[model samples]
Target: MEPSTGKKKTERNWGDKFLNIVEKTGNKLPHPATLFCIFAVAVLLLSAGLAALDVSAEHPDPDIDEKVKVVNLLSKEGIRDILTKAVDNFTGFAPLGVVLVAMLGVGVAERSGLISAFLKKIVMGAPDMLITAVVVFAGIMSSMASDAGYVVLVPLGAVIFLSKGRHPIAGLAAAFAGVSGGFSSNLIITMIDPMLGGFTQESAQMMDSAYTVTPAANLFFMMASTVLITVVGVLVTEKVVEPRLGSYTGSYKQDLDSLKPKENKSLKIALFALIAYVIVVALMTVPETAILRTDEGALLADHESPFIGAMIPLIALSFFIPGLAYGISVGDVKKDKTVVKYMEDTMSTMGGYIVLAFVAAQFVAYFEWSNIGFILAINGAEFLQAINLTGIPLILAFILVSGFINIFVGSASAKWAIMAPVFVPMLMNMGYSPEVAQLAYRIGDSTTNIISPLMPYFAIIVAFAQKYDKNIGIGTLISTMLPYSIAFMIAWMIMLSAWLLLGLPIGPEAPIYY
Candidate 1:
């Protein structure tokens, strides 16, 4: 019998159609490298405009007898100096040096099969309901290892789902949502804590020359955020992602041997090594006599303290030392040469990131030279203050504004460097603490990460998705992840509101108000 028209099978071919559009549009749009160059040019032009108008907060009071001249970017010397200094700073940036150093240990973990083994054990062993939670939890934990979540676990999420007979794209969405969307929320202090803390301190100094912000100021809030984000992430994945995917009958397959029980010897060795490493690190920070502590018997309490400044290096070593030991015991890394090779390999993957960083650094340097960010911030803050808005409304506004800016400029630290100088002090003057302001900025910054194409790693994720289904593209990926993004944003904002109402500290000594 012929099926009725309504019941007849229709070949929608949505995936193919979507890919065609993506390919077409991508061809028309500027190259990613060119896009960055355009951003540099835009910033340069803006700086020139601001300079020509003498629009800056640094100008001397008109009532003062001394006349001050604005530095114009249009001048040959000014343009040359801006470009020269930006290039120099990009080459010599401290964070780039730190990331490169840390990648050495991270590379070994990846190449030695240690990271893969660990992820497989966790994903395969966890119950179905627990998979989402586990992925989110893992995402939170990955911040300790820098960009490992984006680079490693995001693709692994899809592989795990494929092994479980589920839609691999859904798994990718879940992991990407958790890793990038929940980036600011983590159980442990990471390289980002210190980096953002430095910006906060610099901004605070502008208001009160004696003021200093501690790295741990928002630790309490970040710890709470970990739980909040994980729960929200899991719920979104289960309710939104899984349902949308329906019953997966995808052709992707996984090797059952990978899931089979191994000797468990490597697991035990890795476990013991991890425990010992933790104990040693704890000892270093626990006692007043520990060398990592400051004169005041605090770890990472002071801005100039070595412990706070060197935390990234310490974190790198922690991962490397344990991972190295595990590799040697398991015969994955035979000698020191293998370890060095792993380090070099990890660095090789950073070529694109380095280029992005160079362009971003140029934009940042030029913006600073023009003083436009500061001028805008100061004027904006003063306007906000004049309106006498409540603390919550003010912060909420800042979050929205920051989120808008995030779509175009994806670097969190760079965004904060520009926003913090104005927002932090302004909020402080309005009786809010720098920690509160920083937390708000973080929430806004993180929520938009998954949605922004400007984010350096977003394309990497799209490629990861294509590995599972050749037809998948940006639209499909975005649609899959949008639920988590919306859910996370609403839930996180609610959590922040509740925290504010409860007068809970965002971190140790982090307060809602001054």
Candidate 2:
């Protein structure tokens, strides 16, 4: 389903030839849900075979001095375990609840026309000189709201660019690149920061009991990367992607009259509500005696802080209050029942994701139970250690490996859980800090996300693209995004190399050396 951009097939170059192969091969695969089902079954069979051969690894943790064996999921006991745990697996799937809850609030905003109005503000009100950077930076910063970026910004970016008489696909590419490719680069601390930091801490303590990885471990590096990604996004969009895309011929047009006086009033109400909400949140967390602070009088940045755990609900309320305000002002939500209806409608759209989540939950559970990821990580780390590689070259090589593995495993935390226990200690032994190792892993994990089929948001982005160009397919999206992916990897690698040479600290206490 390659898009017919009217370019002759004869003009296709080597990169095009390569991406066509990638897309076609990817398209030949089953749907993500079915693929996860296959992976679950594969994990079961592989576990049984490995258990038969008694394959295992020596657990890396000094406290847990035991060999880790692959658990056989084919046995009667294993079957019973699977049957009983299936429901819990789906319910406990990390992204499932977060996405569903967030969408509930976003649904209200969208239905009440608040979202559209806000997007128009960005599109129409932003200075033309700063629009590209603003869009890219906003996309990067959207990590704070969890998956909201994928749900909102990607589509908005296309709409914004289309309104400006540019290729909408390029806008989509730029936004997707920033949202996913720059996922690890944010000026603010996000849920993933403490989440991955916890993994790094656990792995680090396996080697040194007192070692800890704070939420801010990669803060400085990621802050710098925010700017780097923005610059790269602009460069890739303007210099390569847009020029190749040429003019958009799609029928989608901006509704110039959509923002009525009533809508504008609603928008104003929403904006005021949002400002008030921010003020309240700041007061609750910014002061020494802040209610949102930890028992130790610490702010939201602590690993054990409730604030991070409360992000989903906070995000939901943040959207909900403003959305509710707008809805009331616009008279679209006359009653509480209308808000519930909007929420229901949003859930209705998640049917595909629910199915995918179930299967993916099973796959992830089976992979964990079978101990496959751990064994792979342990053995992979040992192989790298045996080679005795050191310095920036080793870190660069590790980044490439992490990026390659990310194509198959979608979750950043999941991959880091497997890799951290292995690489953190391995790098620590080489006199590199856990923070440095985590930073490198983050770069690899994020840069490859735009190109990975396993990423949960990939299909959603494709659907958004299809809204404009019906002929667009996985191939078209991948081809359009490949440049950004390549550009991010190169730019990030160079930045990391320079940072290392300069002996820069990544965060408050995060140094490059162990």
Candidate 3:
């Protein structure tokens, strides 16, 4: 018994030590927006040095005769271009407009009280045995509604667990695991699908002009990942995370009342509204003569199709309609002014992200304008090929690189914008599809989000945990979520390996090979 106790203490100490290091290191990092500013400065300096040294790479396309060279941002013309195009960079940024449009609808859904009520409806009825899994599953699904899960489900997970006499932090870990760690996995397409897919498509087009990555690029794999993450979240919560938490000794009390009658009616109304909205969208895309389709009536075959272009807006409306229905049913939307106020309030919360996006947009523009990214991708491909690290090994290496970068930069889009320019083209040159590359990046980005201190929601989650146990700190949150991060990484890696071995289609038209 003494030996066993000592072994347990040693093992526990090791985990605590590692998690403490991660928490301290991550906390030392600058805000993600500031990190992008630093990266932009680095890119500028690197561009100048590389340009002076005449660093260049042969264009991959045989049709393109020009060598891609690093353009020095320190040049007079480059300075003029930078000053002139800053606003254009922010406005023309791929994810910005689309995400804003998508979130507008999501904001309506969230502010209408529909998202909260809907999440509660799913979680409140979960059986004691399956409640952890249910909360985690709801968290994963809530990404479809954007950051509403952080606002609704994380705290709700604690309340539900407390109501069931389970450790609330364990429940919060399960929720955070799903909400942040499993963020990249979803049964339905969300803002990220198209957002990352756009980056992939842009990068692939640098090599192959015809490559088209759609919102459904990683749909099948992400759907599978949703199940994998849910199972992992449940197992890690029940097995590793919860046991470590021991018992709930916190005196915080929660009223375990079921969803209100009005909320239930709101859900039904929201469902009907959602159904109606889906039918309207399907009508536009399903018919042969549909204006949203291509000349041959294909919806997604032509990336230029109206349906393809309209998809994100349609997604926003899907949430907006249901939320408006729920809001009206529940009297949250009493007038046009009330609806507008809710939308404003929701968008107001996005000010920080918008600010982050400004810096990220400029960084991406600088990287693109300097052509340093293209040169790096070309050189990186050659280096990898020379070392014979081409296929699965390369994929794993890229995932690790992405995960390492993710520790400091938490926004998926911001990290991907930086990574994709280098990696997507590099992978394409290595004979892998950009879609596959994006999927690998997503795996790395998602798995590490739970443990990253820079994750915008990390502090928010720590606050949530502290509500139950005032002693909860950053390290406590990190230690609790560490299990989920590790479990997710291993399980997700296995799935990716199996996926490659099986040569499965990751999405509708997403091929694994270039």
Candidate 4:
């Protein structure tokens, strides 16, 4: 099924063989939930063995100046701790609550058909000159709304492309590339900034007690990346991915019905509600004495602000109120019971994720408690420090390592918690700032997300793809997305290299040097 791309058979065949091997090896693994369970067990055994070997690292943070040793899960105290915290682990998993809360509002928009209508209107009304770029841009911007892009934009990409007689998978690829692959890139500050920045700050404090890493440390770089990624996404989609995908012959076709009079009226109501909601939010967030503003007068800009904590619930309300307005206008919602039903339906779809989350949470928690990740990171840092690699080469090497690690461990904050304590101090000693190190790690983390099987959303993208072609598998999805990954890695690294070479500030008051 390989299209004649004018490449040599040897080159094409070699690529195909490698992808086949990857697919087969990945398929050989058990289900993701089961795999996480195995990972949890492996951490247990590894921790015990390493503990017996007397492996440990001196704590980086001065407050915890003692040696950090591995806690063997096989021990009596360890087992008891694990058993006691199992429920807490599952409940406290970061993504679980974020996803659930966001979906509650999104569920309303989706079920009320507001999201569908909005997406359809955007796609259908947009000129062909801007459709692909808009989709990619929209996906990139969705970071503010959390994972709503994945659920709403991804499938909509396919539907929009199909409506326009383009290959749907290509559209899916573009959206996935923008959403997951460009995760670290956005025009506005996102939850990721504070999430990873907290880890970076914790690590930096080990070396410099007074060091601080703000959430906006990488804002400038990330903002630039947003534009870079959108352009790259558009180019890859139009030039490479679409040509490779050829024409759409899929069984699934979008029902691109034009809006009826009542639906149009409903859409008008939704628009008015959305505009009014935005105005109210602006009023609350803009002024110095605004209710939603922090005591310092920043609204959702500071990590410690109540606005940050309130964003999820606010997101839910944003969608919910507008969706409710639209639904009521269209007669889709007669009473509160219908809204309750929509939320229930959304919650019901979360069963698989809940099981996966239970196991993943255990694995993450066990890994942290065991301290294997910490020890390895420390040892790795020591080795690199001994070799004394410096400058952009060092940054590039770190990005590559981070990317490789991302394939196995999917959570950004989890991996950073393990890695930052080691790399941050080590790099600071080498005269590079923690913000630079964190930015490098983020480049690595985001570039490979599209191709990594372990990413939390990877399976969902596969399922989304299968809606178009039932034969779509893990390998197929990976192969399809590999180009985006490769292109992003190359392009993003180049961009970062340029920034580093010029010694540009990564963000506001975020210098490259210590």
Candidate 5:
């Protein structure tokens, strides 16, 4: 039975008030790029102020006698250095080229209809009894192709549920939960992995100059999380969300279109091409003397290894080969020019990120060059150490901070650019690996996405939900997704705690402790 009307009303009032506060505060913040610019300027001023005071910290390494001190950035020499290094900083930013290269191939796959058709085939072909689980699983896996799930699978989810004589909103919630709430968990690598890993590596170099973090640093944990999120998402949807949503009583009822013969054939060709490409890559990495292996014959000995360094391009080719194959067979690629045009379209969408990257690069450069990041990290680590908060509790606290910050910052890369220089180095000083810190941040970031108003695609989700139930509002959507967000955070934390206690590697050649 439903809760008493008065009790429900009272609880909703409190939740709505808090969400309103968050929305208003988030709206008051500047655009991310602008925010970075402000931060850069603030860093310059802070550096000058701190330098005047001779603010410094003892190096964390006792063997090092020199203290890391803030450098004044408000002088003529500072301006000259800034002007000279600006372009180099933007160009040298680690995440830039890799994300672009990865997205190029992903764009071809998406534009060729390969990714879209694959999503449809999985969701539409599922048994009636297992449709919810399949939809959620497909949503989690869709990140392998980037943001296409938000555009393709979410609406299709509602349609799939409506056709099954169930509440369409329930299916929308389930799909959204899996896609956004489970965004950090994928069986395969996603663009965010490389992007965030690059940022983490840059931050780690503040303390450990030779340290490197690879895109696969958190792969094993993420793969397990895929199943964890899927199971938890399924349970929440069936037992909590769907039951609460009840049966479909809306005017909208649409049948999901089955995959056409030509698309199905194209998908088969694409899968074959993908499999063939994987085999080729495997051959190049599986043998001791293979071209992609390290000098010592290990395929993935370190980030400097040929296989590890080449992963971004390898991932690109994986998608490019299959996408080209499918597009040709499906007539999407009439000629070579068509493929180039598709790639061009993808680059055009990245104009904003490119702009953001420029300022973000400068901010990171300023923060590092001024020695503020190292000093703060040393002092922060010492403070945490003094409080005896060095292990699981510290990690949990960081996750909570990340999740709270995610509610206001829509872009994961942008947020991480600002946060990693602080948290990654701080955790490193505490004897934790950058991989562990990155994983914790990701867990916090992904779990809050479904309920966060700042997410770019949330409006689209709301519009889709409105098609099924006109009575639905922002409050209703948040209420629906809140369960998924909370459940995902709790379950993910439990898994992370267990993994830490067991001292298992989070990924290939990645240790939990530095």
Candidate 6:
């Protein structure tokens, strides 16, 4: 029999062929925002179906005749309330406010050419084998600054890799793994600390009337997790990603001309100024009587501690001071007008981000107002509890559930807002601590972030890959990263399970139970 014209099979490797199929399909796929709207409709339909069938559950309602009420999406008041809340929620979200404020300083750093110069110096000096490791390390560190890893380090990884005659895509993957995959784990506390802590507190309160989940609840565990992820990320980049890429020999070349060195005198002055700023900041954060600390000596745990609550502003200044010095030295900021321009320019880049955030905020608010998330969470928790699974099996199941949810909804805090209320209380009822539940959620959230299209930066990654291979698409990127995602998932779960069995503290004064 002759082969059909519609389906002529070639002798290509299955992996390569699979990638080809994905690229073709992705090319034909609708735009991401359109896809999101489609999914939102589907969610609406599903909610509608549940309402019609009266399959939804509700918690105690003091004023109502029935404790459990059917979710009515058709109700005009309900829909109006949801839309109103969504709009209000997006505009009022605190993180957006924080980012905007911090960017004023960061903009100055980036514009002064300080950030680029510093990165170039580091890249030039780093060893060959250590290049991938350093990119990953920096990605982990950049988490302290929030979203800078996505905007700065991930693209820089591609640039660095291309410069070194390695596959740029592989470099991007390694950095993405560190930035998004290791999002929850970091050496230093970040804005995420307080965000997650807020969610944890909400979850814990379901069981305890006066419960509190500290911002540093998982600090120790996160510190260790940072080391674990870095080791794994570096190994995977070298062993798996590099070997698969097989000596790039591609036509792409680095634009070293873009990286002009600063004048000697300016460089020297900036270096001194940077040193002075760092010493001052360190002194404020270090001693028992440091100004950044509370009277009791705690840095962030106390409300009165400057270092604790003012970390974001401090971060902004860290970048701004060095950037200002560098800019002044390099004559990039010859006038006060130039300095203000740098700050303004930095804020401009955030325009697209703000739009995305607005949409995401609405979606999150709508989800919360509908009460559908809470209902689903409670039911899901009950089902999991009924399975009677324990230890590794239970933890693994939670990881899988988290990974699955990540594909549809990318926000960690939003997902936790829904999941924590149910899982934390259920687990606590089953003798697991709120810390353990939160840790499990973190593991799941982190491991799958790299591969999920729902992730806000997934599109950015696809764009990065296309710069290397025009034929590349979402599938190509996902396939390349599947190995790292799988490896990290298994390894992270095992690490968490072992930690749980040992009864060790996840962080300082952070216990695994009520």
Listed in order, each prediction's TM-score against the native is 0.72, 0.87, 0.68, 0.84, 0.64, 0.76
lDDT of 2 by residue, 150-213 (tens): 8767877887887777788878888888898556899877768878898999999988999988
| lDDT of every predicted structure (CA atoms) | 0.69, 0.81, 0.75, 0.80, 0.77, 0.70
lDDT of candidate model 6 versus the reference: 0.70
TM-score, candidate 3, is 0.68
For residues 1-514, write the lDDT of model 3, one tens digit per residue.
1111111111255665576566555546566567678878998998899999999887755456888788999899989988999999989865566656767887888778787676577656567559988889988998764555665568768767876767777778888888875467898887567678887787778778887888898889989988999988899888777766676655675544578998888899999999988888878879999878888876655346677677667777888899999999998788999878877886776676578768878887887788865555455445545666778888987776667667755567766765676678878887888999999999888888877755656655765676676555566677778878888888988889889989999998888988
> What is the Cα-based TM-score of model 2?
0.87
Please rank every candidate by TM-score, starting with the best.
Answer: 2, 4, 6, 1, 3, 5
What tens digits encode model 5's per-residue C-alpha lDDT throughout 1-514?
Answer: 2211121211234554554454345545565567678879999999999999999987654445888889988888889889999999999866567657877987898789777676577655566548988889989987764565675568768767776767778888888988885568988777578778888998899889999998899999999999999999999888777765555656675544678999999999999999999899889989899999877896644356777678778878887899999999999899899999989998886676677677877887887788876565456445544665768899987777678767755567766766677678878888899999999989988999888754656655765676665545556677778888988999999999999999999999899998
Ten-residue region with minimum lDDT total, candidate 5: 1-10
In candidate 4, position 138 carries an lDDT of 82
Cα deviation of 485 in candidate 4 (Å)?
2.5
- The candidate scoring highest on TM-score is 2
Worst 10 residues of 1 by lDDT: 2-11
Instruction: Tell me the spans in candidate 3 whose CA falls farther than 4 Å from its real position.
Output: 1-12, 127-226, 236-257, 389-489, 495-514
Best by lDDT: 2
> Which stretches in model 1 have alpha-carbon errors above 4 Å?
1-28, 57-74, 93-95, 141-176, 179-223, 239-263, 302-304, 379-383, 386-388, 405-439, 449-485, 499-514
Off by over 4 Å in 6: 1-24, 41-49, 58-75, 78-90, 93-107, 145-148, 188-220, 242-254, 257-265, 279-314, 340-361, 409-411, 417-434, 456-477, 500-514
lDDT digits (tens) for residues 267-369 of candidate 4: 9999899899889887887789888777778665544676667777777888898999999999999999999999999899777667877887888889878
lDDT of 4 at 56: 88
Q: What is residue 208's positional error in candidate 5, in angstroms?
A: 19
After TM-score superposition, the amount by which residue 411's alpha carbon in candidate 5 deviates from its true location, in angstroms, is: 15
Clashing pairs in 2: none
lDDT of 1 by residue, 113-151 (tens): 666667667666568767877777777778765565776
Off by over 4 Å in 4: 1-17, 125-129, 145-152, 155-159, 162-169, 181-183, 194-216, 239-251, 301-304, 408-434, 459-477
lDDT of 6 at 110: 70
Compute the lDDT of residue 133 as modeled in candidate 4. Answer: 90
